[model samples]
Target: MSNPPELPEFPSPFNFINNVPITLVELRMRNFSGQIREKPRWWEKVHDADIVAKWRSEIIEQDEKVVEQFWGGEKRFDDGNGEKKWPREKITGAQLDYIFDELKDLAQAIDHETGIQRTAIDKVYQSKTLIPADLKTVFLSGVSILESVPPEEQDWHPGANDQVLDLVHPSLHCFRIGRSPVLIPERTSGCPDPLFVLTEEQYLEMREDAEGAIVSQFISTNYQWLPTDFEVSQPGRRLYSNITSILQRFLPLFERVLSDSSDPPPPLAVAANPGGWYEDEESESDLSDDEMDARWRKFHWPVIHDPAPFSPPTQEGRTPLSLNGRKLQVIIKLANIVLTPERPKYPGGSWHVEGMVNEEIVATGIYYYASDNISESKLAFRAAVGDGTDEAGVSWNYEQSDDRGWTVAFGLRQWRSMNQELGSIMATEDKSSLGRGRYSAFSLSTRRGPSSRRATFPAATIVVPRRAGKVPALRALPQEIWDMIMQYALAGTVSLEEAKQDRLALMEERSHFVIEHNREIFEVEFNMCEH
Candidate 1:
């Protein structure tokens, strides 16, 4: 083998992952720089077991006393003539009004910026859009306050039963739900917040409720701290009104954020290309007929096809694989092909190759031989006999077959599954040509044979029809598609059985998706290793 090309320089350790300084904004929010160490308590230093035990007992007693007085003490306000029971500190109508005012000021500040001053605001807005809308919808479903009284648990606020907040995601800087309800009894904190002490039965019921209930619930029966407007027999109208007013103030913000990001980019297309190495035009001339045969045998002899040490080089200019001047049998697996329709017009195509591997699928795809005599290597593709629908399928067995659909050249690599061109075609919707073929296009296999072999069809020979729209074709292969191809290449060729064992081993490994940004590109990465 020849000396390999020099690898690209690795990026520096402190290099910015991307141009965005959003990381700085996130770090600032955490305020790690301002964190202070706490002084250790006297009990922490007391090694004497008896003394430590006494301190713990005393602390527990004091905590109990505090809880009792906060709940039971009748702290009264001395009015000029009479004493009235002091109301517990719960979210009141006035507090709601204050919250709205504060939020209004923030929104106004966000909208007031111009030119350079708007940079921070724009970054924040862009960051907000990164979160998914379905996730926001889930959070905005709001909270349910469940009240557990002795053996029975009921919703504390009845209005919550029928109300869906339709509020913005808390992460969008709209507003955050305050302290979560704690699972303990305390003097200052109680039921109005949906704060709760869960009983075994209530916990089980909550587990059953799950996502089906739509809203989150916290159960506690301490209704004494509830707002004055809450009559024991009725829904807390005043408290509901306050919450309604506060959420109403945030409606415009949510509307603006959602509207600005209404249309999202289409999902990335991903596939496992079971094909072998993709070579370029530059490498073919160097090999003699005997040398080529040896190389082919080396590549295909392994039970699991491994495609390492080579890839379709972007610099050398990739070309289609040549079939050594021989008319070879091409078996196309309908299951390996991707199609546009959701409820596909043709179903059960996968059964054609239910128990086979990539090597078994011939005519996986046809390719131009990258020379003047392109026609000899190019195989004729036609609609397979018998199958009449626009669905992708072709006959692998000729004697037992009749009609089929159009076939296209699949991949330049031995594994046609990695062909991005084919993927794009599969992803596209075809335009009706008034029953006339205007140009040329590719297609997948169709129609099952009586035997176990997957349906086969010739690719690359059909005259494609004219496409409907002016959708701009991709100028360069997307990084995502390229990376996926590389991953398949590195994984080498492994048969289904080898793949199963490796998957089991992977189950025991720690893995996570790592994302890295390169200027305009975001690369999502995962390792496919065989341990």
Candidate 2:
């Protein structure tokens, strides 16, 4: 008897196999590879002579106004004489040309289709006037929820050193899928299907009921109330309808980013050179250190050369990118930073993503609704491209001598983890000036799956710790005795030992779940050669 020969595996373009879906991380990687050599949509527009000329003319025409608007007033230049004059009145022709050139470059970098500002492609979107003017009153009314909380009862974000106030944070009471017991009965074969969730009418009705319950509690507690208390006259609903309305307004922008990430277009066969890079060494001898360093960036910057057209694999029954009939889990977060003479500067935030692997968060939208007397802040973005292992045989086949050419063309460094640096969005007073307090709303969109269920927190379980104070009795006890006392205090039950054991088991289960989920999505090796 002869054994059958092993068949060679063929690569499939589809994002699924046997009805099972691929991870979002893998899809992002695929999209990245697919567009490796493709030029950005703005490449041609930025290079067109007529377009560049038009942009230059426009900048020159609006130079004075632009200067005033940016500088927050007319900026006067100090001439050698005693007189201080406007920049246009005192500056040379070269200074004006330089300003115009910079503005032109900025205008060229923006892409209308993606609504992406600067040179970061389609990753970030910003709008100054997305929320309607009428919604301002409603938003302020919702903000009263935070203002109502007493200073002593305010919930500062964990580990934020009393700087960040969390009015409504999902991390405190989030929907825990699969861990909690299911309340809703499972659908049977003959049972009618449930109506769609998050519809405008249904949402408003739910909000009204929830708001009433919350306001009822506030009134019962005699909290500092305001005329805007009517806005949040419900329980369960943390944010008023104002937040919902704002999210609805930005839905289009969210959709655009999601579409680009999930189902990107095939790469186009076009060559785009951004220019201004020193391509030859002839001019290097006369250049200064800064000039040389600037020119050398072309070698280090990532760019794809001679990109060929790409045709993605076809999936027979693939669903198009849309939110029309899908179920979405939205986690809302509202927080504000208070800066005074004592604490004038916010040192900025660290680099991190939105949620844990188990959360299945696909997209995040942040709205800086208000700020005052603060310096400029920016929200930058970066992505984990790869661990450099994938590029060794495929994209890194150049010698040291060819480093300049390779880097200039490919825009990647060899033998290193690829952390693609995306540009930033500036958050300033002029950009987001709705109220006196510096408030921000964060909405994280997580895709709901069939096996997932929302978990609710019991009001009794939530314990807000008192302000810093020493417990003299506990401080005198040994470490082991102190730990046991804390465990008993936390359990508050006769079966304290059993509860402790159960807690350990639950912790292990959650840890395993998170690790497994992340491994499935992010731990695999991405094949860059596929594209």
Candidate 3:
């Protein structure tokens, strides 16, 4: 084989892996520049035996406190003001808030591996034009606060019921619920902020009650801390206004970081996946060709035997194992493929494929292969697909959408259960095309069959008739259709030969541009790998 290309030289001993900074803006690549090491605590040391004895004593004390405050505390208090009347110094709301603040600070410092200063994660996802509206409508649904009253606990806060937890998810930002009504005497330190989001619909359904219940229970009872307002200016008097900003966080990623108690990950080493082991395993499990053919025939019938008067295209194609290299099937999904009558109609003739299902129009999204030019050893794409009524109701599977339904291709190295796949560019060319001012254009799979390098209509999408207004047909390749198909070299779509010509032209233009500004064109990077 050939040598693996070396990573482009970057900076010194503080290299990318364990050192380079990354942020939302520079999410161009996933490879990191650092090591994941266990942080050791120093300076405060004790002998092993002494440490064990101290831990045992602490456990015993905690258990005794639990029992004294919860099980029998009720028998002691007459008016629910907790058992022992501990002073403010013993335990105050201020103390616990400080602990959370410290933890947040420590977490930030620990995760300070930095990158570029691009837009925040939440901002990119919030664009309506970037994501489909239906897909964006995600949030929390319902919330109810439970209060626990361990009578003999501290009067300042008393029982565990006083500890209020606000669980905010997508649709619903804050569901500040007290899990168990029974409260502990002193303040509970870990009132889980495992914020689970609510869907827009569920939030609308239960928002009013959940909000009221949380507010009444927290301020009216225990210590209020978890930033009731964006900034905790007057924590004692802040209301639900702060919920919006605090809720604005990228809840999913934060939740993963904070609450995930995942098992210890398996070590990453070459010995774990030796090549011979996989080969032998596959050899042992080989299936007979005859059996494979029999199974194949089972799926060979025309998807649509007696097609509907206005039939849709067949989207039930499998990854013809005959054509399998890498499971990656990247199709530039456009919005116009949406053919459900509830929303829009197809461009021309009804759906017809090598096989068709007896439906009005081929339901919608069709999956297929890339062009020969895309045969470059490695290439990635930016993609978008329609999430409409066709994908809803019943014809397709259950769908999840955000507030604004525009979709974007994030990484090519993902197994998307949706349209389009993405990755990095290995090598490529480009080209451009022009609309004949009139004839309708349709996109179809142009992958080569096994027989020859010759291409065939392996698949086709049912085009919904688009009324391209004054948006010059050539320029308006319909955001969905022309977005990815544009030949990179030409700045738009073009024939193979034309794309090659464009590549040459771009190289020449770049050469001139660089001569005009040579210093910056070729960056001189320094490295300390060996030096």
Candidate 4:
């Protein structure tokens, strides 16, 4: 046949073949181009076939030489004798190259699901008649090399080539690619060791997540041991502020989480948690117990002391906001008066406030519904006035806990001064003087309200001392002398010159009368002449 003339150019390369118009055979060839004409692509061996086998073998041979060099031409076989041992040394660039170069040894079959032998892979790649396949492989050989090298043997000093690190990083497989899990390297190098295997972004992200978790843990459990502003570093400052901001933002959710009484909490759509810079050493470490305790008291006490922004408790019809300020003030004043006989030092009472406001004691009583003996409205408080009793052996009216019952009592002798009301208040076995007298010493008998076993203060009832039937002998003093005595008692002052010249001064100087409240009255007669 005569030589066929050239066909007209078509839009695509497969539009025509052998000087003929487009056909099925040409289309088939176009669809599977490289299968019929196999070309060995060594560059793509890692993802295709074992063309890089030679490269892998060479790198392994080089690694052996590098190992020899590391030992200074002397090898130790660990002969189980104490006589000879190899000294620890840093790795070299040549060793790093050999370690990373072994990545080429891995080969996958045409299906890319299982491993294939290097010999079979080589045949698949070089065979001219063999069909092309996506014979991808996972490069575990380099990972094996890295895993074999101990961390101590790695050169961890700075000043390594960035390109070399970049080349070695992909083989370490620190993270995942799609559904496949990556294999992290056992050995690392460079200052900030992760730099040898992780990108800066990845490293930063990991650190940030870790710091946030630490912050969360501290907020949940170690709030008492937080560091103070003076003791905190710059990063710690950021951590504190960040945590505070996060708390403020999600305070309601946290309150709900905390208040949930059920076994399994209801599902909540949590907000994006903010990150912080709380130092792991300061918050997470167990070292320096005393120092941590001090810091916790210094830094976190204020939060515990105030805590107004958080959820305020509620009583009958009152809220914590209404009760905390003026109400607390009134309670504190009365507590001071009722608790002072035995409590020489005043650090303020442990007044737990629930709710507030109104005119009379009856209408304004903080109602507490006791679910059970142990379960009462959160609006209750327990206070301690004195260590024990006054000289007269009468216990100062205050809260006391025992195995059987917990006596929670409070009274204000001068209720008018506090601008507080009184009403149907409960009494305990110990007997409180909180009676329904407008201005009289209001005392409530202990056994009047609830059983001593449960010791539940009645709802809508206040605890006050009942009025004493007899006036304490200290009140029997003449008003003038009593006023002088009170002034002297308050001032804790005495002078001889003033005593001889003035009646008030004489009373103050001649006698040291200790007016004991909440107990029997007694007077101490003093003779200045004796002194």
Off by over 4 Å in 2: 1-120, 175-179, 187-239, 265-320, 386-396, 400-416, 429-531
TM-score per prediction, in order, is: 0.16, 0.46, 0.14, 0.12
lDDT, residue 358, model 2: 25
Best by TM-score: 2
Instruction: Name the top lDDT candidate.
Output: 2
- Number of clashes in every candidate structure? 34, 14, 84, 26
lDDT of 4 by residue, 1-531 (tens): 443232221111101111111111111112122221122443245443343345445444544554354333323221112221111122233332322232233222231321111221111111111111221011122222422456554322122221011111111211211211111333212212211223334433433222432222211110010011122454345433432332232222221221221122222111111111112334748648897766643333100011112122233432111111111111100000111222212122122121111101111121111112221111111111222212111222212211011000011111111111111122221111211121112122232344222221111221111211111113344475446445534443324333223333222321221112111111111111111
lDDT of each residue in 500-524, candidate 1, tens digit only: 3443333222011111111101211
Write the residue-wise lDDT of candidate 3 on 247-342 in tens digits: 222222222221111222121111111112111112323668886555443332111011112222232531111111211111111111211223
User: lDDT score, residue 304, model 4?
Assistant: 7
| Count: clashes, candidate 4 | 26
lDDT of 2: 0.37
**How many Å off is the CA of 91 in candidate 1?**
48
Q: CA lDDT of each candidate?
A: 0.22, 0.37, 0.21, 0.22
On lDDT, the stronger of 2 and 3 is 2
